[model samples]
Target: MSVKETAQEVLKKIGGSKNVESVTHCVTRLRFVLRDFSLPNKEEVASIDGVISVIEQGGQYQVVIGNKVSEVYDEVLKELDGSDPTDKIESKAHHKSLFDKFTAMISGIFMPVMGAMAGSGMIKGVLAILTITNLLSEESGTYIILYGLSNAFFYFMPVILGASAAKYFKMDIFVGAVLGAALIYPTFIPFASEGELSFLGISVNMMDYTSTVFPVIVAVWFASKVNMIAEKFMPKDLKFLLVPAIVLLISVPVTLIVIGPIITLLSNVLADAVNAIYNFSPALAGAVIGGPWILMVMFGLHWAFIPIFIANMASQGYDPMMGLLLANQFAMAGATIAVGIKTKNDKLKALSLSTGVTTLFGISEPALYGVLLPNKKPLIAAIIGGSFGGVIAGIANTVQYSFGGSGLLGIPLIINTSGIDNGFYGGIASQIVGFIVGFALTYTWGFKEKSTVDSDDYSGNNTLLNTKINVNDILSGEVVALSEVPDKVFSEGLMGQGLAVIPNDGKVYAPFDGVVTMIFPTKHAIGLTSSDGIELLIHVGVDTVELNGVGFKSFVASDQKISKGDLLLEIDLAVLKQSNFQIITPILITNPDKFSKVSHENNNLILAN
Candidate 1:
């Protein structure tokens, strides 16, 4: 489908534009906040073309659309009520947790500028290399221009963040910029050297706001709140002039006196704490963080560390945090390549090799979710490899001078401005160790091929012609009668007759599998036809579809051929137990009429003979 069609279909599936309170996009997903959480059918949404998956996380319905997310976001905007994203922000009546709001706010502020920020960071890295090698003279006009291009963004970070923050806070963009500019205004910035300045005869604290993160966000939030109150009482005729004037007079001084210094202090504390962690035991810090870094990325939890990374860069001119985790990408690539080399399946080999290439470019998601994760053991190997390399890097005190790619292409970013040093060699050595260990371990024992099911297991029409079948447990859980289920639809045998299970583990396995007929969009349910003609519907929990694919993960695709005991899905029971929904999963024989006797076995197994 075209991008526009995909956008429209996604909108329709999510109860249309009217249901959306607001929408935003990160690198690969379209995030939406809905007025009614239970309005959309997740199964239908996931089945849409161009969508990779659906994830409900951090109070947003995230549609995974891969590289086309930005295009789809634009198309989505065209279908919304207004051109300004702030127009939709007015409808954010839904409540989000403090952490959720903070993360969302930070991401919103930074995402718009990330492209430029990364490019500028890369330029700085490149310049550092040229100057170190004596290929470029720092005093030359060319060097000066390049340095300005690279440094200007970080030098005036407050202004950039202010403009972005205004968009996030639904305030006047220029007003936000002016407030940011006022902090570093040529005449005023010198006062920071003076320590304190008098404003209207009142003592005002002075601090440089350049390259800061928190101050502008707090300032814009305060300004937005002020603008909101002003709009309530001020005449609309005078709002254009008087509202901005009032906001500037109040916000600029408040920010200069209170917000800037406080945030700067807090930022310093945070930076110091990070340094303390590293200083206490750099190896432990590196191993602890780097070992599970891929898992953190998988669950979208890595966003929590971004502020720390930014703060470290702004305050210390370089950060060791990213360098500690740099081995992860290499480890992932190594595992993928190992899988590619060892797998007998041509399709698996092809995918493993291709995704391995992507991992080298610092795009490890493709390899992670597609290759290593599904294989299980290779992921562990990668983790082990990454942790080992991380320890070495920590010992060497490798540092990342700027944000850029995390793979071979970003080697320059680890180069110290002083000259080639132990840190630079440590970074290169870490990647080497990560790759070799990951590859060696995976190739030696991390992967073992599974037995394949015979093609004659079932008929083309999904009916068992002559063979008998036994339906094993779809998951490891306590089996109970279907009538014991709380919901009327399943308790009353309206959907079909079968047993219900209280799962002890989150994984779902295939029972007498032939082909996967369907997977529910929310991934809470599955439809399967056994080789011997038993058609079963494995539903995870009661009313789980309302959760919108949050804790559920489907491994098999629709119509895929599979063997019995193959992993079909994984659910986070912990996340579900917190909700009101019951975790009783009903495994129903949807085509019960095909047999006269469908007996339930005593060993918690279903026998259709």
Candidate 2:
């Protein structure tokens, strides 16, 4: 199918052009904030041709379309809006939940730094192994260089975290980073040494700031809130300077005296609790963590565990959690690989295969986003496999001696001659076994049967059995017949024979067996010529022509034969709103003079087939 066809199908399945509120794109996904999530037939949308997956998280409905998402997003916008992009905001406050907010915060703050953190962690783990094996000396210059590079991320974590937190809070990220840096300055170090110290006559005695987590986050959050208030009250001319001054003055002291101590205490308590649990029953701890590892990945909160692993490695030179996590990685990888092999769609197969490889290399974002999350069965299989593997690793008392990288290859770092002897081979064997079991199970019994044939059945031509079309078969909304439409071109019968459909959603689809004749390069309008010579022009969303082709994507282009009910477009209505375009879509026929009469049968739920 061509891009145009895909775009139309997406729009229709999601409940037509009017249902859309706004649209946007990030990397490989189209992020949409719908005015009404209820309208889109999610199951049908997922089953549409050219779509990879649909994910609903953090109050956003994301469509994963792989590397071509940008191109598709552009086409979708053109279909909704003609030349200008929309700029409208949908109120997400109503949909906000504690879990949703927390996940959003974590994802926004941690995603960007993940690569750097992983790279540094891996390097540090390698250094630990070298030192443990007596292959490097503590004072060696080469070791120091590598160690410094690896240590940089941790030593300056507050800065990175602060920037990410600022972004989450929609505040000035640079200022937040500077404030975080201030917490670790030499001036604060003295407060750690002396019995008592004061900052500007305020008593400053609490937890040490170095290697701290909660202080910067709390401070930045406060700063963001203060900045917002200041921006509103202060005069436009002085707002920038005033906001920063007020935010810093209010936030720094609050952080030093209250936020830092409270969060530090909480962290310590949590750490102590985890340590106690581990001490009591390592196997139980492993089992508990392993069982829910997939959940952590889904919510994107796994980053929180990084500091714990680092602390354990620094204090005791080994951690059991890391070993168990390795099992989790392989389970996901194996499941993804199995799915890749089973898939017949070339695009899905390639994505699954690539993601599987990346999972093996300890980067599972592609797999998590593109494959596992959409296919529920594979994810469940992986979780079960991971848990079983964790049980084995725990029973054997396998522990990792370093804090970097994860998955099968990281096994070497876990083997310490001086530590508990589980033999390197034992850890390796458990991980391999878990991976194989997960792959085999998912391939054989975990998944639903995928479609082997093309979606052409839904895209072929069919003669309308009768001329009396039911408007209710289309969908719910204010109904207006073709003659009632205000546009002269539409009322004068210049377009076509079909009724003028004012969709509640910004979606459109093939009305009958036809061949797409012209898909406006901007993606705003599509022309379909039925096999019976009835021509149709589906101009999606009123005034969406102004979106300048931003969030629209098409599946089929000009001259492609289509059947009734075929998907033609997928639009990001959120983007349309963001670009200040209307969501109401107008379906018109460019060759209206040829038809005897155009009429509406009912006002809701239009059925083309």
Candidate 3:
């Protein structure tokens, strides 16, 4: 197949150009950020020609194409350049499981800016250490600037979250940003402390929303819904301005009065429940938390633990749960380091080594997705190591004085204000024990290293590009761009790419050797599946399906074999014109993403090889 056709097949297998939000290439992979997870067929993607592997990591759909990925990436971009991609419409049709969907959402939302957030959290720890040690005075200008730098992202967490959430939720970004800002606005902070509040005669349950997760997410969600609903009644000319304006007006009030308080209360209740559990038994709590901690991190279930940890620090003097959970990070990192050393495959070694470095810095998505889960034995070893470490931490009553990442930066956060307290020393000891345990266990028991696939050996099963069109002559009609169609559904290229033809004659012919998949009862359209695996849908006229065969006749039967250029249908153009039905017949490749190119020329659509 030509390079152009290969890109089309690749794009289709990954859920099409519309599903992709962005595309780029690293050394060996075509990285795509898809709007919906369920739309891509992984099996088909893996079977594509020139693809070495498929990896879904940190919400990216990666096609491992070896060294030629950049060439393919360039082609993929060219093929999709003119298409105005849409997201939310495709998202609603996704069929992913709830856990998978939520994992994707969290990964997509946080992965982009996690470095900034983590860096700021680390600085907060630095600030705490500096103040406790008297190295920086609280009243000093140096300390004040550092404190502001450390606190900014956390203080404006709602706005940051809202902007990201809006991108994922398919709403206007600034609208999401403004809504988030309004939630944590300085004026509203005082209102939450008051007894009661009301907005437009509606009772408002005052709740502190600063640094909270669910409120802005809920607000953006409602805004997206409102935007969709408003599109119908909104005038086309005024839609660009009025739809977002109306959505913001409704969503902000609804969020403050209805959504914000409910989610905050839930967060508080969750925090209290977790604290009660921690108070029940420290060792048991550590065991339970550590054993599945990486798994929680993997699916982002650990986000639920964040507010709880903060609450413990706020209500009490310090948080023990976060310290207890710290072993999991070092343990996983150690296990991955062992994998890097033990693996025979060059790619696996590189992946494990880089991911190990990432985990050492408290980012475990790379380690979990790229190594541990794929290598089952190492994951088990890491869990066991973490469990042992957690027991030691719990017994030592490990606690942290300030917020920081769970990697090396955590050590300073747990340091004692006094010389050498058990809480601080024990916390340090637990991590060392966890790393040794994990590295030893994994190095001794090892993972089964799966060698890379020889890309040349596993050739693709289909011959889509090899099959000839049989009728090479230009089609007899007036071929037009998809946007020229009267219906928005067709004009938007939503039903798949092809052309609307104003046919001078009634005849419609089979474009390739295929089996008739269906003949519409009304006879306005015929569906055929090509021998090479293409699907073609030929509609005789716009909305003519409603005519009930009044102005159309289909000559093919379902399951019948068809040859190229065989007469399949005839339409009574005069009857359709008289009845006010459009005679602009549309020849649509219903699964246009399956082809390398769908181009209109001299009254013909040349599906490229």
lDDT values for all models = 0.79, 0.67, 0.72
Give the per-residue lDDT of model 1 (tens digit) for 1-609: 999999999999998787887788766678886877666655467668887567665667878776688999999999995434444323435567887777767776777888888889899899989989999999999999999999889888888888899987888999888888887787877788866798888788887777778888898899889888987899989999899999988899888888888888887887788788988988898798776888877766676677678788887889888888878888899999999998786877887898788788786765775578756789999998898888888989998998877778678899887899999998888888888888889999887553222223223332323333333347777777777776645664546667788889999888775999999889999999877777788999877987899998889999999898899999999988876567989887776546544445442323323
Better of 1 and 3 by lDDT: 1
lDDT of 2 by residue, 33-85 (tens): 56666556444565566676676776556676655666778788887785233
Error of 2 at 377 (Å): 5.2
Candidate 3: segments with Cα more than 4 A from true spot? 1-16, 21-83, 86-93, 303-320, 339-358, 363-375, 399-406, 412-421, 446-609
Q: What lDDT is obtained when candidate 1 is compared to the true structure?
A: 0.79
The reply for model 2, stretches above 4 Å from the true place, is 1-51, 65-92, 129-137, 299-319, 336-358, 363-379, 396-405, 409-427, 440-609
Model 3, span 357-451: residue lDDT tens: 77777766567655776567788888988887888788888887567667786777786544447877778778878888888899988464432
Supply every candidate's count of residue pairs whose N, Cα or C atoms clash at under 3 angstroms. Answer: 1, 104, 0
Better model by TM-score, 1 or 3? 1
What's the residue-level lDDT of 175 in candidate 3? 82
Model 3 residue 192 CA deviation (Å) reads 2.0
| Candidate 1 TM-score over all chains jointly | 0.76
For model 2, what is the alpha-carbon lDDT of residue 504?
A: 60
